[model samples]
Target: MSTTAPIRLGTRRSALAQAQSGHVAEALSAIAGRPVELVPIVSEGDTNRASLSEIGGTGIFANLLREALVAGKCDILVHSLKDLPTAMPPELVIAATPARVDARDVVITRDGTPLHELRTGSAIGTGAPRRIAQVRRRAPHAKVVDIRGNVDSRLARVESGDLDAVILAAAGLSRLGSESTLHREELGLAEWPTAPGQGALAVETTVDAPAELLAALAELEDEDTRLAITVERAILAGLDVGCQAPMAAHAVVSGDSVRVRAVVYEPNGEGRIGLDVTESLNRGYIRRNGSGNEANAADGADPMRTARDIGDSAAHRLLEQGAADFLPRE
Candidate 1:
């Protein structure tokens, strides 16, 4: 393939998205032996700062990119894996998800104050239902407020004293080189499993993308990374919950198997249930090299059944242990 026809990569206008997409483009260029171009598409999530639920949840991030792809405005779309809806449109599929970044959340505050040390009734800001749920459980007394924007804009709130502290993904901050401003709290997955597919980037393409384009993306796929996200998202799709719902999940690849850690929390984060499950990713999960099919666990497994198992076997177990009463009852 010639480096002449640039692969128009679609991405959100946020700094995090740009940086992450830039990284993806560079990696893809190296793999394809050609240059790739990025096309910034302002999404509904960006245009409207309203509640994610009001804007139709996290799927909005994919809408514009999919539109661009369908319209031939861009050849490829890139997104934060966590933000992509569990179910995708039939025409657009995730072609590749390079190895993930830090798959954890970080709390940003002035003077490096830990979450537990904040003054009574101090306000904690976050736009994500998952963070709201998890933090409230850890510090029930702290006030939780919804806030949004790119990482810098959100942190500005704390810097300006508008918020006592704010929670954001550690990966985005690290990607932006702003890790120094935040106190990285390594919340264990058992206590705070992340959203499904968190800390990863998904490269998308039309279902009928040219075979050469598909071959170019092959250089970006990582098997272990694929397996980890597959099971985590598999658990999410199994739950039948939209991104607006209060859900948290994390998965990692062990030696020869994959283990998924997840949580389902109340909106207030006071009540929750979470669990961990390990299965052989190598067993049924296909691993392919160069120009082969990518396994994202998109509906291959029965989500309802897996969710029930995770809820009953893993999550419900936590509930039966009186863990479900931490937050307000539904």
Candidate 2:
């Protein structure tokens, strides 16, 4: 839509970032009938070797890209949805949410050891409190060490004998095309639901973008995937938590309802509060995108309202179960 220049898509410079941006660029080119330029920006997260949360959590990765957007250095931004904050500036908006990839987490271990099969007291490297808590609960004997690095770097720790295993998001490994080559054990979604919005991509654009460009990009939005993520994020928002929170959520749509399973964990993995709730999507304006059926249309419940309702219900339910007791003490 910009007659003066090609649309620029900004992203981080790491291999996974490049891979993700390249993918979005290709899809945008195909859908918009115009090629999009990829602008690789180096984020503080890429340069800082310290703990991600210490430096400022995953938002460090989004800061530079967002700055580029506000400064008019790029026309759009593609971020891992899980890394994005729960709230955003009104001037910037997520314009498109393409179909999400697998959202489960996986364990990468030496000699192809599954999680439960790991030797007692074995060292496992990971920094995510959510993962640490779940690892502690599921494999209490294994030593969970705080780790910081990219997918390959973390996996290298296991390969080099620094740790017996490491836990990582399956989405990253798959995006980098290393899943097939690694010894992986996918954690159960029911037990380890993964971070909210994990495996999903968010395409952000300025509020002032051309209406035509916005509409074209919106075509990439998959309503079902977006709805599922909405449930997850909405729950997080209701809890007033961010990406660094020790929480996990997963949603699945069936018939005219969305079932959201979520958890809140204590910092030390000593306890947890969890809930699984299903809400009907038939209150007003039946959803025509996902699992569309004449039956769904017959009810007339609002899908958006239902999504928020399910998320709010889950949050309140967890709170009633003493979710606050599980929060990592400041």
Candidate 3:
């Protein structure tokens, strides 16, 4: 706690990465009463403009930063939770994820048009397999094209007539301050559930991090956000799927129950295995504190176990209903 050196937070040099890390730095600084400097690290993913599937690596945005962390080049690493692989290395962990923003995807189109109003056969650009499947399912006539770039660059395609529309994370656009100025439509979550942890940030550190730093970071953890994403990712892990595959999972916490919905799509986007399941967190969380209430709520439950159960059960339900048939082959 007495270290005079500011904590170096490693991040990709992209504008979005800088912005997200900058936000985390401010929060951590306040919590630790110490300075947090954002250290820009160029990730291989940032360097490669090819499609993610073409690149063929997991945690494209995060692995490079992780290398830096392990090498003592940075004290902290921030990642888009969705870009993080479902499995964490034994030496590493996500220490915190601030409260989540909108977890839904949005479409930005030329002429300020929404998805339903777009013309037939229009080229809609997106690099994500999950988005491609949903787009094809909801708008059968539109064409899905692979695209690679930052938020602004992708948005520019629509302006320059290279594409009639583009799909992006509403959370990213909002963080970059471009959500309101552009014409966009937020997709319905029921039909277009997003990636496991889309819209959430992952704050990673080594398992043996300084106790002071770990405690400070924990102050920023949002239990609700963590549990929701954990459930989504657990379902993914239970199904043994990769990010490049066509899959989407969404979780919502309502009262005492957590409702989780997941879908695994055929590569062609012509079919899918969709299922929804709910799990009660009451037993796992409430009994920990003798006089449990809102102030004591966060630590009151073992949400991680509950989330795993929900995810595993949901994936099992889908498998029972033939989810495996639609999954992409290894």
Candidate 1 per-residue lDDT, tens place, 52-144, comes to: 644547577778778888998998998888888877788888889889888888778887777877888999998777788778888888998
TM-score of each predicted structure versus truth:
0.84, 0.91, 0.92
Selected candidate, larger lDDT, 2 vs 3: 3
**Whole-model lDDT per candidate:** 0.75, 0.83, 0.84
**Which stretches of model 1 miss by more than 4 angstroms?**
1-3, 53-56, 179-182, 284-330
lDDT of 3 by residue, 121-165 (tens): 999998888888778887788888999998988888888889998
Extract clashing residue pairs from model 1.
194-249, 238-303, 270-326, 270-327, 271-327
Q: After aligning candidate 1 to the native by TM-score, how far in Å is the CA of 189 from where it should be?
A: 2.7
RMSD in Å for model 1:
6.2
Candidate 3: which stretches are off by over 4 Å?
179-181, 283-301
What lDDT score goes with residue 122 in model 3? 94
Q: Pick the candidate with the highest lDDT.
A: 3
Candidate 1 Cα deviation (angstroms), residue 230:
1.2
